[model samples]
Target: MSGRFDRRVMVVTGAAQGIGRRVAELAAAEGARLVLVDIADYVQGVAADLRDQGADVLALQADLEAWEGAESVMARAHERFGRIDILINNVGGTIWAQPYEHYTPAQIQKEIQRSLFPTLWCCRAVLPHMVDQQAGVIVNVSSVATRGLMRVPYGAAKGGVNALTVNLAYEYAGQGIRVNATAPGGTEAPPRLTPRNTEAQSEQAQAWYQRLIDQTNAHSFMHRYGTLDEQAAPILFLASDAASYLTGTVLPVAGGDLG
Candidate 1:
Protein backbone atom coordinates (compact mmCIF):
# COMPACT_ATOMS: atom_id res chain seq x y z
CA MET A 1 0.00 0.00 0.00
CA SER A 2 2.95 2.30 0.61
CA GLY A 3 4.26 1.78 -2.94
CA ARG A 4 7.73 1.45 -1.46
CA PHE A 5 8.64 -1.11 -4.09
CA ASP A 6 7.09 0.71 -7.02
CA ARG A 7 8.09 -0.86 -10.33
CA ARG A 8 10.55 -3.18 -8.67
CA VAL A 9 10.90 -6.83 -9.57
CA MET A 10 10.28 -9.09 -6.57
CA VAL A 11 10.12 -12.78 -5.84
CA VAL A 12 8.49 -14.52 -2.88
CA THR A 13 8.80 -18.24 -2.28
CA GLY A 14 6.35 -20.48 -0.41
CA ALA A 15 3.85 -17.79 -1.18
CA ALA A 16 0.73 -19.86 -1.63
CA GLN A 17 -0.66 -19.31 1.86
CA GLY A 18 -0.26 -17.96 5.36
CA ILE A 19 2.67 -15.65 6.08
CA GLY A 20 4.17 -16.17 2.66
CA ARG A 21 0.91 -15.30 0.93
CA ARG A 22 0.45 -12.17 3.03
CA VAL A 23 3.99 -11.08 2.38
CA ALA A 24 3.57 -11.50 -1.37
CA GLU A 25 0.32 -9.54 -1.30
CA LEU A 26 1.93 -6.75 0.66
CA ALA A 27 4.82 -6.56 -1.72
CA ALA A 28 2.46 -6.45 -4.67
CA ALA A 29 0.43 -3.70 -3.02
CA GLU A 30 3.66 -1.82 -2.59
CA GLY A 31 3.88 -1.80 -6.40
CA ALA A 32 6.26 -4.68 -6.95
CA ARG A 33 6.00 -6.81 -10.08
CA LEU A 34 5.92 -10.21 -8.47
CA VAL A 35 7.05 -13.75 -9.07
CA LEU A 36 5.27 -16.03 -6.62
CA VAL A 37 6.84 -19.44 -6.13
CA ASP A 38 5.46 -22.33 -4.09
CA ILE A 39 5.49 -26.08 -4.01
CA ALA A 40 1.72 -26.07 -3.72
CA ASP A 41 -0.89 -25.81 -6.45
CA TYR A 42 -2.35 -22.78 -4.68
CA VAL A 43 0.48 -20.66 -6.02
CA GLN A 44 -1.34 -20.31 -9.34
CA GLY A 45 -4.41 -18.99 -7.60
CA VAL A 46 -2.40 -16.63 -5.46
CA ALA A 47 -0.65 -15.23 -8.49
CA ALA A 48 -3.94 -14.90 -10.33
CA ASP A 49 -5.37 -12.95 -7.44
CA LEU A 50 -2.46 -10.56 -7.52
CA ARG A 51 -2.82 -10.19 -11.25
CA ASP A 52 -6.51 -9.42 -10.84
CA GLN A 53 -5.54 -6.76 -8.36
CA GLY A 54 -3.42 -5.11 -11.07
CA ALA A 55 -0.08 -6.46 -9.93
CA ASP A 56 2.24 -7.81 -12.61
CA VAL A 57 2.68 -11.36 -11.35
CA LEU A 58 3.87 -14.79 -12.43
CA ALA A 59 3.05 -17.81 -10.33
CA LEU A 60 5.35 -20.79 -10.60
CA GLN A 61 5.24 -24.17 -8.93
CA ALA A 62 8.55 -25.75 -8.06
CA ASP A 63 9.90 -28.12 -5.49
CA LEU A 64 12.38 -25.82 -3.82
CA GLU A 65 13.68 -28.74 -1.83
CA ALA A 66 15.79 -29.70 -4.82
CA TRP A 67 18.69 -27.77 -6.33
CA GLU A 68 17.13 -27.96 -9.76
CA GLY A 69 13.92 -26.58 -8.39
CA ALA A 70 15.57 -23.45 -7.09
CA GLU A 71 17.47 -23.03 -10.32
CA SER A 72 14.30 -23.39 -12.34
CA VAL A 73 12.45 -20.74 -10.37
CA MET A 74 15.35 -18.35 -10.66
CA ALA A 75 15.55 -18.99 -14.37
CA ARG A 76 11.86 -18.30 -14.86
CA ALA A 77 12.13 -15.02 -12.97
CA HIS A 78 15.05 -13.86 -15.04
CA GLU A 79 13.32 -14.90 -18.23
CA ARG A 80 10.07 -13.17 -17.35
CA PHE A 81 11.17 -10.14 -15.34
CA GLY A 82 14.71 -9.59 -16.63
CA ARG A 83 16.13 -8.97 -13.13
CA ILE A 84 15.20 -9.66 -9.58
CA ASP A 85 15.58 -6.79 -7.16
CA ILE A 86 14.08 -8.30 -4.06
CA LEU A 87 13.71 -11.89 -2.87
CA ILE A 88 11.66 -13.05 0.09
CA ASN A 89 12.61 -16.54 1.16
CA ASN A 90 9.56 -17.67 3.13
CA VAL A 91 9.55 -21.39 2.35
CA GLY A 92 11.36 -23.25 5.07
CA GLY A 93 9.32 -25.33 7.55
CA THR A 94 9.52 -28.46 9.68
CA ILE A 95 7.61 -31.65 8.92
CA TRP A 96 8.38 -34.40 11.41
CA ALA A 97 6.94 -33.81 14.86
CA GLN A 98 8.47 -36.75 16.62
CA PRO A 99 11.07 -36.69 19.37
CA TYR A 100 14.71 -36.54 18.35
CA GLU A 101 15.16 -40.23 18.94
CA HIS A 102 12.25 -41.13 16.74
CA TYR A 103 13.66 -39.39 13.68
CA THR A 104 15.16 -41.61 11.03
CA PRO A 105 17.96 -40.69 8.66
CA ALA A 106 15.45 -40.13 5.88
CA GLN A 107 13.32 -37.91 8.07
CA ILE A 108 16.34 -35.86 9.02
CA GLN A 109 17.16 -35.34 5.37
CA LYS A 110 13.55 -34.45 4.60
CA GLU A 111 13.49 -31.89 7.36
CA ILE A 112 16.64 -30.24 6.09
CA GLN A 113 15.37 -30.28 2.53
CA ARG A 114 12.18 -28.48 3.49
CA SER A 115 13.37 -26.28 6.35
CA LEU A 116 16.94 -25.30 5.41
CA PHE A 117 17.83 -26.10 1.82
CA PRO A 118 15.27 -23.74 0.29
CA THR A 119 16.95 -20.71 1.82
CA LEU A 120 20.39 -21.94 0.87
CA TRP A 121 19.42 -22.78 -2.68
CA CYS A 122 17.58 -19.53 -3.28
CA CYS A 123 20.48 -17.54 -1.85
CA ARG A 124 22.94 -19.41 -3.99
CA ALA A 125 20.83 -18.99 -7.10
CA VAL A 126 20.24 -15.27 -6.68
CA LEU A 127 23.63 -14.02 -5.51
CA PRO A 128 25.31 -14.06 -8.91
CA HIS A 129 22.57 -11.90 -10.41
CA MET A 130 22.72 -9.49 -7.47
CA VAL A 131 26.45 -9.34 -7.61
CA ASP A 132 26.41 -8.63 -11.32
CA GLN A 133 23.90 -5.82 -10.87
CA GLN A 134 25.54 -4.65 -7.64
CA ALA A 135 22.12 -4.10 -6.13
CA GLY A 136 19.54 -6.38 -4.48
CA VAL A 137 17.71 -7.06 -1.25
CA ILE A 138 16.95 -10.43 0.33
CA VAL A 139 14.71 -11.03 3.31
CA ASN A 140 14.76 -14.55 4.68
CA VAL A 141 11.95 -15.52 7.04
CA SER A 142 13.18 -17.37 10.07
CA SER A 143 11.47 -18.12 13.36
CA VAL A 144 11.77 -16.99 16.98
CA ALA A 145 11.37 -20.64 17.79
CA THR A 146 14.95 -20.97 16.65
CA ARG A 147 15.79 -19.39 19.97
CA GLY A 148 12.74 -20.30 22.02
CA LEU A 149 11.62 -23.79 23.00
CA MET A 150 11.12 -26.11 20.00
CA ARG A 151 11.87 -29.59 18.79
CA VAL A 152 15.58 -30.10 18.42
CA PRO A 153 15.66 -30.67 14.67
CA TYR A 154 13.51 -27.65 13.76
CA GLY A 155 15.52 -25.48 16.11
CA ALA A 156 18.72 -26.65 14.52
CA ALA A 157 17.44 -25.98 11.00
CA LYS A 158 16.16 -22.53 11.87
CA GLY A 159 19.41 -21.77 13.67
CA GLY A 160 21.13 -22.48 10.38
CA VAL A 161 18.74 -20.02 8.72
CA ASN A 162 19.66 -17.35 11.29
CA ALA A 163 23.33 -17.97 10.60
CA LEU A 164 22.71 -17.85 6.87
CA THR A 165 21.04 -14.45 7.23
CA VAL A 166 24.10 -12.86 8.81
CA ASN A 167 26.61 -14.64 6.66
CA LEU A 168 24.86 -13.73 3.42
CA ALA A 169 24.39 -10.15 4.53
CA TYR A 170 28.06 -9.80 5.26
CA GLU A 171 29.12 -11.78 2.23
CA TYR A 172 27.17 -9.56 -0.14
CA ALA A 173 27.53 -6.24 1.68
CA GLY A 174 30.65 -5.29 -0.23
CA GLN A 175 28.89 -6.27 -3.45
CA GLY A 176 25.97 -3.90 -2.78
CA ILE A 177 23.41 -6.60 -2.11
CA ARG A 178 21.75 -6.23 1.27
CA VAL A 179 20.53 -9.35 3.03
CA ASN A 180 18.63 -9.60 6.31
CA ALA A 181 16.05 -11.73 8.08
CA THR A 182 12.59 -11.42 9.62
CA ALA A 183 11.99 -13.78 12.52
CA PRO A 184 8.33 -14.15 13.45
CA GLY A 185 7.08 -15.04 16.93
CA GLY A 186 3.95 -17.07 16.31
CA THR A 187 1.12 -17.84 13.91
CA GLU A 188 -0.15 -14.67 12.23
CA ALA A 189 -2.44 -16.35 9.70
CA PRO A 190 -4.14 -19.56 8.67
CA PRO A 191 -2.28 -22.86 8.24
CA ARG A 192 -1.54 -21.52 11.68
CA LEU A 193 0.83 -24.14 13.05
CA THR A 194 2.74 -27.19 11.97
CA PRO A 195 0.74 -29.64 9.92
CA ARG A 196 -0.71 -32.55 11.85
CA ASN A 197 -1.95 -36.04 11.04
CA THR A 198 -5.58 -35.19 11.55
CA GLU A 199 -6.82 -38.66 10.77
CA ALA A 200 -4.51 -40.50 13.13
CA GLN A 201 -4.43 -37.92 15.92
CA SER A 202 -6.18 -38.81 19.14
CA GLU A 203 -8.42 -36.46 21.12
CA GLN A 204 -5.64 -35.90 23.65
CA ALA A 205 -3.27 -34.80 20.90
CA GLN A 206 -5.93 -32.54 19.44
CA ALA A 207 -6.53 -31.00 22.87
CA TRP A 208 -2.80 -30.52 23.32
CA TYR A 209 -2.58 -28.83 19.94
CA GLN A 210 -5.40 -26.50 20.83
CA ARG A 211 -3.74 -25.65 24.13
CA LEU A 212 -0.54 -24.75 22.38
CA ILE A 213 -2.43 -22.64 19.85
CA ASP A 214 -4.14 -20.80 22.68
CA GLN A 215 -0.86 -20.29 24.50
CA THR A 216 0.72 -18.79 21.38
CA ASN A 217 -1.76 -15.93 21.55
CA ALA A 218 -0.36 -14.88 24.92
CA HIS A 219 3.26 -15.95 24.48
CA SER A 220 4.50 -12.47 23.73
CA PHE A 221 4.20 -9.18 25.58
CA MET A 222 1.40 -8.09 23.27
CA HIS A 223 -0.85 -10.95 24.40
CA ARG A 224 -1.85 -11.83 20.82
CA TYR A 225 -0.62 -13.43 17.67
CA GLY A 226 1.33 -11.11 15.41
CA THR A 227 -0.87 -10.18 12.45
CA LEU A 228 0.08 -11.08 8.88
CA ASP A 229 0.42 -7.38 8.16
CA GLU A 230 2.57 -6.86 11.25
CA GLN A 231 4.84 -9.76 10.41
CA ALA A 232 5.16 -8.62 6.79
CA ALA A 233 6.12 -5.07 7.74
CA PRO A 234 9.63 -5.82 8.93
CA ILE A 235 10.24 -7.99 5.89
CA LEU A 236 9.05 -5.24 3.59
CA PHE A 237 11.25 -2.74 5.38
CA LEU A 238 14.26 -4.96 4.96
CA ALA A 239 13.36 -5.45 1.30
CA SER A 240 13.13 -1.74 0.63
CA ASP A 241 15.54 1.21 0.48
CA ALA A 242 14.41 2.12 4.00
CA ALA A 243 16.82 -0.53 5.23
CA SER A 244 19.62 0.29 2.84
CA TYR A 245 22.07 0.83 5.67
CA LEU A 246 20.96 -2.32 7.43
CA THR A 247 22.64 -5.66 6.82
CA GLY A 248 23.51 -8.80 8.80
CA THR A 249 20.73 -8.05 11.30
CA VAL A 250 18.01 -10.49 12.25
CA LEU A 251 15.04 -8.19 12.87
CA PRO A 252 12.59 -9.94 15.12
CA VAL A 253 8.95 -9.27 14.23
CA ALA A 254 7.88 -10.78 17.53
CA GLY A 255 5.86 -8.71 20.00
CA GLY A 256 8.66 -7.97 22.45
CA ASP A 257 10.05 -11.48 22.33
CA LEU A 258 13.57 -10.50 21.37
CA GLY A 259 14.72 -13.96 22.20
Candidate 2:
Protein backbone atom coordinates (compact mmCIF):
# COMPACT_ATOMS: atom_id res chain seq x y z
CA MET A 1 0.00 0.00 0.00
CA SER A 2 1.32 3.41 -0.88
CA GLY A 3 1.67 5.61 2.18
CA ARG A 4 2.18 9.28 2.96
CA PHE A 5 5.81 8.78 3.98
CA ASP A 6 7.06 6.85 1.01
CA ARG A 7 10.85 7.19 0.90
CA ARG A 8 10.78 9.97 3.47
CA VAL A 9 13.66 10.11 5.90
CA MET A 10 12.19 10.55 9.37
CA VAL A 11 14.06 10.80 12.63
CA VAL A 12 12.28 9.84 15.84
CA THR A 13 13.85 10.37 19.27
CA GLY A 14 13.05 8.37 22.42
CA ALA A 15 12.07 5.44 20.23
CA ALA A 16 12.81 2.61 22.67
CA GLN A 17 9.22 2.25 23.84
CA GLY A 18 5.87 3.88 24.57
CA ILE A 19 4.74 6.76 22.35
CA GLY A 20 8.04 7.04 20.57
CA ARG A 21 8.11 3.38 19.59
CA ARG A 22 4.52 3.52 18.43
CA VAL A 23 5.33 6.50 16.22
CA ALA A 24 8.25 4.63 14.72
CA GLU A 25 6.03 1.62 14.01
CA LEU A 26 3.34 3.64 12.30
CA ALA A 27 5.81 5.71 10.31
CA ALA A 28 7.61 2.61 9.14
CA ALA A 29 4.34 1.13 7.94
CA GLU A 30 3.84 4.31 5.94
CA GLY A 31 7.20 3.84 4.12
CA ALA A 32 9.47 6.09 6.14
CA ARG A 33 13.18 5.39 6.27
CA LEU A 34 13.58 5.54 10.03
CA VAL A 35 16.35 6.63 12.35
CA LEU A 36 15.19 5.46 15.76
CA VAL A 37 17.06 7.03 18.65
CA ASP A 38 17.02 6.40 22.40
CA ILE A 39 19.56 6.24 25.22
CA ALA A 40 18.43 2.70 25.90
CA ASP A 41 20.38 0.02 24.00
CA TYR A 42 17.18 -1.91 23.37
CA VAL A 43 16.16 0.57 20.71
CA GLN A 44 18.29 -1.55 18.41
CA GLY A 45 15.77 -4.31 18.92
CA VAL A 46 13.02 -1.96 17.83
CA ALA A 47 15.03 -1.22 14.69
CA ALA A 48 15.51 -4.94 14.11
CA ASP A 49 11.81 -5.60 14.32
CA LEU A 50 11.10 -2.91 11.75
CA ARG A 51 13.83 -4.24 9.49
CA ASP A 52 12.27 -7.68 9.63
CA GLN A 53 9.04 -6.11 8.49
CA GLY A 54 10.84 -4.78 5.37
CA ALA A 55 11.37 -1.24 6.50
CA ASP A 56 14.63 0.69 6.18
CA VAL A 57 15.69 1.46 9.77
CA LEU A 58 18.67 2.52 11.84
CA ALA A 59 18.75 2.64 15.63
CA LEU A 60 21.08 4.81 17.69
CA GLN A 61 21.61 4.99 21.42
CA ALA A 62 22.14 8.58 22.50
CA ASP A 63 21.48 10.61 25.63
CA LEU A 64 19.39 13.37 24.04
CA GLU A 65 19.46 15.28 27.31
CA ALA A 66 22.95 16.46 26.22
CA TRP A 67 23.85 18.91 23.44
CA GLU A 68 26.50 16.56 22.11
CA GLY A 69 23.91 13.80 21.87
CA ALA A 70 21.43 15.91 19.88
CA GLU A 71 24.13 17.07 17.45
CA SER A 72 25.40 13.57 16.93
CA VAL A 73 21.95 12.15 16.33
CA MET A 74 21.14 14.68 13.61
CA ALA A 75 24.58 14.40 12.05
CA ARG A 76 24.42 10.62 11.85
CA ALA A 77 20.80 10.60 10.69
CA HIS A 78 21.53 12.94 7.81
CA GLU A 79 24.63 10.94 6.92
CA ARG A 80 22.56 7.76 6.69
CA PHE A 81 19.43 9.08 5.04
CA GLY A 82 21.02 11.77 2.83
CA ARG A 83 18.39 14.31 3.92
CA ILE A 84 16.02 14.66 6.86
CA ASP A 85 12.38 15.31 5.99
CA ILE A 86 10.81 14.92 9.42
CA LEU A 87 11.98 15.29 13.01
CA ILE A 88 9.70 14.07 15.81
CA ASN A 89 11.04 15.29 19.15
CA ASN A 90 9.66 12.72 21.56
CA VAL A 91 12.35 12.51 24.23
CA GLY A 92 10.78 14.09 27.28
CA GLY A 93 8.62 12.78 30.15
CA THR A 94 7.82 13.40 33.80
CA ILE A 95 10.04 11.44 36.14
CA TRP A 96 8.25 12.14 39.39
CA ALA A 97 4.82 13.08 40.66
CA GLN A 98 4.52 15.49 43.60
CA PRO A 99 3.67 19.01 44.63
CA TYR A 100 6.08 21.85 43.86
CA GLU A 101 7.23 22.08 47.50
CA HIS A 102 7.96 18.39 47.72
CA TYR A 103 10.62 18.60 45.02
CA THR A 104 14.22 19.44 45.81
CA PRO A 105 16.14 21.95 43.72
CA ALA A 106 18.02 19.08 42.12
CA GLN A 107 14.74 17.36 41.23
CA ILE A 108 13.45 20.49 39.50
CA GLN A 109 16.66 20.79 37.52
CA LYS A 110 16.48 17.13 36.59
CA GLU A 111 12.92 17.60 35.38
CA ILE A 112 13.99 20.50 33.18
CA GLN A 113 16.93 18.51 31.88
CA ARG A 114 14.76 15.52 31.02
CA SER A 115 11.78 17.36 29.55
CA LEU A 116 13.05 20.64 28.11
CA PHE A 117 16.69 20.61 27.04
CA PRO A 118 16.34 17.71 24.62
CA THR A 119 13.74 19.49 22.47
CA LEU A 120 15.61 22.77 22.67
CA TRP A 121 18.95 21.22 21.78
CA CYS A 122 17.53 19.04 19.00
CA CYS A 123 15.81 21.97 17.36
CA ARG A 124 19.01 24.00 17.48
CA ALA A 125 21.02 21.13 16.09
CA VAL A 126 18.63 20.22 13.29
CA LEU A 127 17.81 23.75 12.10
CA PRO A 128 21.01 24.16 10.15
CA HIS A 129 20.23 21.05 8.12
CA MET A 130 16.60 21.95 7.58
CA VAL A 131 17.51 25.49 6.65
CA ASP A 132 20.20 24.36 4.27
CA GLN A 133 17.75 22.09 2.49
CA GLN A 134 15.06 24.75 2.73
CA ALA A 135 12.46 22.18 3.70
CA GLY A 136 11.59 20.14 6.81
CA VAL A 137 8.93 19.34 9.39
CA ILE A 138 9.26 19.23 13.19
CA VAL A 139 6.65 17.84 15.56
CA ASN A 140 7.32 18.09 19.26
CA VAL A 141 5.53 15.84 21.74
CA SER A 142 4.44 18.09 24.58
CA SER A 143 1.89 17.38 27.32
CA VAL A 144 -1.45 18.51 28.73
CA ALA A 145 0.20 18.15 32.13
CA THR A 146 1.45 21.69 31.67
CA ARG A 147 -1.67 22.78 33.58
CA GLY A 148 -2.07 19.73 35.82
CA LEU A 149 -0.91 19.08 39.40
CA MET A 150 1.73 16.82 40.92
CA ARG A 151 4.30 17.63 38.21
CA VAL A 152 4.98 21.31 38.39
CA PRO A 153 8.52 21.03 37.07
CA TYR A 154 7.56 18.78 34.21
CA GLY A 155 4.66 21.06 33.42
CA ALA A 156 7.02 24.01 33.29
CA ALA A 157 9.30 22.14 30.96
CA LYS A 158 6.47 21.31 28.56
CA GLY A 159 5.31 24.90 28.77
CA GLY A 160 8.76 25.81 27.52
CA VAL A 161 8.27 23.34 24.70
CA ASN A 162 5.00 25.01 23.78
CA ALA A 163 6.74 28.37 23.62
CA LEU A 164 9.59 26.93 21.59
CA THR A 165 7.23 25.42 19.07
CA VAL A 166 5.49 28.67 18.16
CA ASN A 167 8.65 30.76 18.15
CA LEU A 168 10.59 28.30 16.03
CA ALA A 169 7.74 27.96 13.59
CA TYR A 170 7.78 31.71 13.15
CA GLU A 171 11.55 31.90 12.74
CA TYR A 172 11.79 29.03 10.26
CA ALA A 173 8.62 29.41 8.23
CA GLY A 174 10.39 31.65 5.74
CA GLN A 175 12.85 28.83 5.15
CA GLY A 176 10.15 26.20 4.52
CA ILE A 177 10.31 24.45 7.89
CA ARG A 178 7.01 23.78 9.61
CA VAL A 179 7.10 23.31 13.35
CA ASN A 180 4.17 22.15 15.49
CA ALA A 181 3.42 20.17 18.64
CA THR A 182 0.99 17.61 20.02
CA ALA A 183 -0.01 18.08 23.63
CA PRO A 184 -1.11 14.65 24.73
CA GLY A 185 -3.28 14.05 27.77
CA GLY A 186 -3.32 10.74 29.63
CA THR A 187 -2.48 7.86 27.30
CA GLU A 188 -2.87 4.12 27.88
CA ALA A 189 0.19 2.08 27.06
CA PRO A 190 2.10 -0.95 28.29
CA PRO A 191 4.03 -0.62 31.56
CA ARG A 192 7.28 1.19 31.01
CA LEU A 193 10.15 -1.17 30.32
CA THR A 194 12.51 1.15 32.13
CA PRO A 195 10.65 2.95 34.84
CA ARG A 196 11.26 6.69 35.02
CA ASN A 197 11.52 6.36 38.81
CA THR A 198 12.75 3.34 40.71
CA GLU A 199 12.05 4.51 44.27
CA ALA A 200 9.23 2.70 45.99
CA GLN A 201 6.30 5.04 46.39
CA SER A 202 5.25 5.94 49.89
CA GLU A 203 1.55 6.15 50.69
CA GLN A 204 1.54 9.90 50.20
CA ALA A 205 3.43 9.61 46.95
CA GLN A 206 1.08 6.94 45.65
CA ALA A 207 -1.89 9.04 46.63
CA TRP A 208 -0.45 12.02 44.81
CA TYR A 209 0.10 9.96 41.67
CA GLN A 210 -3.44 8.65 41.84
CA ARG A 211 -4.72 12.16 42.23
CA LEU A 212 -2.92 13.16 39.05
CA ILE A 213 -4.61 10.32 37.17
CA ASP A 214 -8.01 11.23 38.56
CA GLN A 215 -7.48 14.86 37.65
CA THR A 216 -6.53 13.86 34.10
CA ASN A 217 -9.78 11.96 33.60
CA ALA A 218 -11.90 14.57 35.28
CA HIS A 219 -10.45 17.32 33.10
CA SER A 220 -10.79 15.41 29.83
CA PHE A 221 -14.03 16.10 27.99
CA MET A 222 -14.05 12.45 26.91
CA HIS A 223 -13.43 11.44 30.53
CA ARG A 224 -10.77 8.87 29.61
CA TYR A 225 -7.24 8.20 28.51
CA GLY A 226 -6.37 7.85 24.82
CA THR A 227 -4.58 5.00 23.11
CA LEU A 228 -1.08 5.11 21.65
CA ASP A 229 -2.48 5.30 18.11
CA GLU A 230 -4.55 8.33 19.00
CA GLN A 231 -1.42 10.17 20.06
CA ALA A 232 0.74 9.01 17.15
CA ALA A 233 -1.82 9.85 14.48
CA PRO A 234 -1.82 13.58 15.16
CA ILE A 235 1.97 13.62 15.43
CA LEU A 236 2.27 11.87 12.09
CA PHE A 237 -0.22 14.24 10.52
CA LEU A 238 1.77 17.24 11.68
CA ALA A 239 4.85 15.67 10.15
CA SER A 240 3.18 14.90 6.83
CA ASP A 241 2.52 16.98 3.73
CA ALA A 242 -1.14 16.86 4.73
CA ALA A 243 -0.34 19.52 7.31
CA SER A 244 1.47 21.61 4.74
CA TYR A 245 -0.14 24.88 5.72
CA LEU A 246 -0.25 24.20 9.45
CA THR A 247 2.62 25.62 11.46
CA GLY A 248 3.12 26.89 14.97
CA THR A 249 -0.05 25.08 15.99
CA VAL A 250 -0.13 22.96 19.14
CA LEU A 251 -2.90 20.43 18.63
CA PRO A 252 -4.30 19.19 21.91
CA VAL A 253 -4.87 15.43 22.03
CA ALA A 254 -6.28 15.85 25.51
CA GLY A 255 -9.99 15.27 24.87
CA GLY A 256 -11.10 18.80 25.81
CA ASP A 257 -8.14 20.22 27.66
CA LEU A 258 -6.76 23.12 25.62
CA GLY A 259 -3.39 22.70 27.27
**Best model number under TM-score:** 2
Clashing pairs in 2: none
Candidate 2 overall lDDT versus native: 0.95
**Tens digits of per-residue lDDT for model 2 on 1-259?**
1499999999999999999999999999999999999999989999999999999998999999999999999999999988999999999888999989999999999999999999999999999999999999999999999899999999999999999999999999999999999999999999988999999989999999999999999999999999999999999999999999999999999899877
For residue 120, model 2's alpha carbon misses the true position, in angstroms, by 0.6
Weakest lDDT window of 10 consecutive positions for candidate 1: 190-199
Candidate 1 residues lying further than 4 Å off, grouped into runs, are: 192-199, 203-219
Q: Model 1, residue 191: displacement in angstroms? A: 3.8
Model 2 bad stretches (over 4 Å): none
